[model samples]
Target: MGKIVISSNVTLDGVVQDPDGAEGFALGGWFHRFAGSKDLEDWAARETAELLGVDALLLGRRTSEWFESRLRPGGGAEARVSPEWADRMNSIPKYVVSSTPEPPRWNNTTVLNGDAVKEISELERTVAGEILVYGSYQLVRTLLEQNLADELRLVVFPVVLGTGLRIFDETGGKPLRLVDTRQMGDGLAFHTYEFVRG
Candidate 1:
């Protein structure tokens, strides 16, 4: 069985919106503010290590489109990251939960056209390792609400953005067991929590 892990970079205030400033949110680009810091570099290294173990990626429709636009080969965004990292991202098996019939344009992507919970539940049964979810807020909420996600890995930055779209906005209360915690440098706190399912 695959462990559905939600790996997110959130602010101190639990805001998950527009970390990269791509969406034009008022408080956007909070994540890149610490781009060149030693702490941020350490935190990114840890994230890279975690990503190395991921077998697949689960994404929402909008997030899928966003990645397609920014991360695709010859798309100009590949210049921002290392070749190996870009290759891993491009080659990973991706499943996008989309109601629309239009297929996702990213390489190695498959559109899950039916019910979100059912599609992901079936995916969990077939996948053998970690299925990482990144920047898909709506999909993350659905997974939490439907009891589909297995773990939550949050890299909490030190800064507090006053307001933004939070991941747990409309999510119901779900118990979590702390599995791991790591302080990356002085600014980043990495925490892993396993969902307590009955």
Candidate 2:
């Protein structure tokens, strides 16, 4: 079976909201506030390249909506994606886990409206490469609860948001194994962990 990887950009306090400054929330854009140094950028680039190898990209409803809106014609955040990044994104297959959405506007996107774990499991069994999940906070929570994630790639910035979305919910659980951890020059940290099933 292929691996299911969850990659996210989170603050020191675990807020994974709009880090790109596109969201209207005053405190939504925290990623830019904590600028990382060269070491951090190099680490991020390597991680991103690895994630791009995943056969499919899984997204939550809200994240799918945000991406669609930004990629939409005449959208305000259309400039967010550079030409190279746009091409890279377009090359990957995207699967959006949503209930209300009819269909996504992206060229290579599929709508998954059923049980998240079952669907994801089936995809892993049939897909040829890793399954990557990015930025879908709610979906990530659900996957964690169901023990569907095989690995977690956390890019933690140096700032903290006292009150915002958190990476881990209050679902009582055992500890995860800290597979690896690295500190970057810009105070950014990279942590790789795996759920230690009993």
Candidate 3:
């Protein structure tokens, strides 16, 4: 079975929406303004390593559009991810959960246009490594609600946007076991949690 890893950079208030300030949210680009020292480099390195290990990606339509525009060749002037991370994003198989197939013209991307949980469940049986997730807030909530997420790796930045779309919003409050926690230099903290299933 494959592990589903939900990775994101969130604020102190759990706001994950438009961290890059793309969606015109009031608190958009909140994540980049944090004045961190060495933590930012470490966080990028860790994400690159994680991407190297993953076999596939599961993304919602919005996130899919973001990645397709940024990660593909000749794109990404705003949020230029590292070349190593970009390689994995472009090379790995991406199963995007969307309402239409006309979008996200990135290579090696497959659109899953039906029930997300059911499709992801079926996908788990076919992959051996990680089914990595990034910036898919609604999908993350569903995964947590249905007890499907295996691990959550959050890079918590030092900022609190008190009123934006939260990552844990409306999530059906599931307990999780802390697998690992570390200081990524500066004030940033990296936390890994595994979903607890009884």
Candidate 4:
């Protein structure tokens, strides 16, 4: 069985919105402000490794479109993930959860318009490696609500966005056990948490 790992670059305030400023938030591009530090580079390397470990990806419609637009042929390199990350993303099986039909311009992408919980649960049964969800906050919430996610890996940045689209919902009471922690030189905190069930 595969593990459902929820990953993100969030703020101290649990705000996961518009880190790259691509979404046009007022505090957009906040994550880019810390780009030049060696700590960020190391963090990126760690993220790349974690992402490469996944055999499949679960992404929401918007996030999927964002990734597909940048990852398609002849797209600007700056608009995509790192070279290593790109290689893994292109090769892995991507199941996009979207109600609408979208022609995926990227390679190895599949659209799953059925029930989120049922489709993802079925995917977890057959996948031998990790099934990662990155930058898909809505899908993450659904997975957590259904108790389907196995691990939560958060790369928290130093900035605190006072207001933004947060990952935690009002009824978000999922139990998580701390599994790992690493503080980077650039003041970023890397945390790994496993889903806990009574």
| Number of backbone collisions per candidate | 0, 0, 1, 1
Runs with alpha carbons beyond 4 Å of true place in candidate 1 = 34-36
**lDDT, candidate 3, 19-100, per-residue tens:** 8787899779977688464777787888889889889999988888877777656675335467778877888999988877
Q: Looking at candidate 1, what is the lDDT of residue 16?
A: 91
- Cα TM-score of candidate 2: 0.85
Residue lDDT tens for model 1, 87-159: 7888999999988999667889999989888889999999999999988898999998899999999888778
Which has the greatest lDDT? 1
Deviating ranges (above 4 Å) for candidate 4? 78-81
Model 4, span 103-190: residue lDDT tens: 7766888887988789989989999899999898888888878899899898888887799988884436788899999986667889
Instruction: Give Cα-based local distance difference scores for all models.
Output: 0.86, 0.76, 0.84, 0.83
Per-candidate RMSD, Å: 1.4, 2.6, 1.7, 1.7
Count of clashing pairs, candidate 2? 0
Cα displacement (Å) at residue 152, model 1: 0.3
Worst 10 residues of 4 by lDDT: 72-81
TM-scores of the models, in the order given: 0.94, 0.85, 0.93, 0.93
Candidate 3: residue 175 lDDT (0-100) = 86
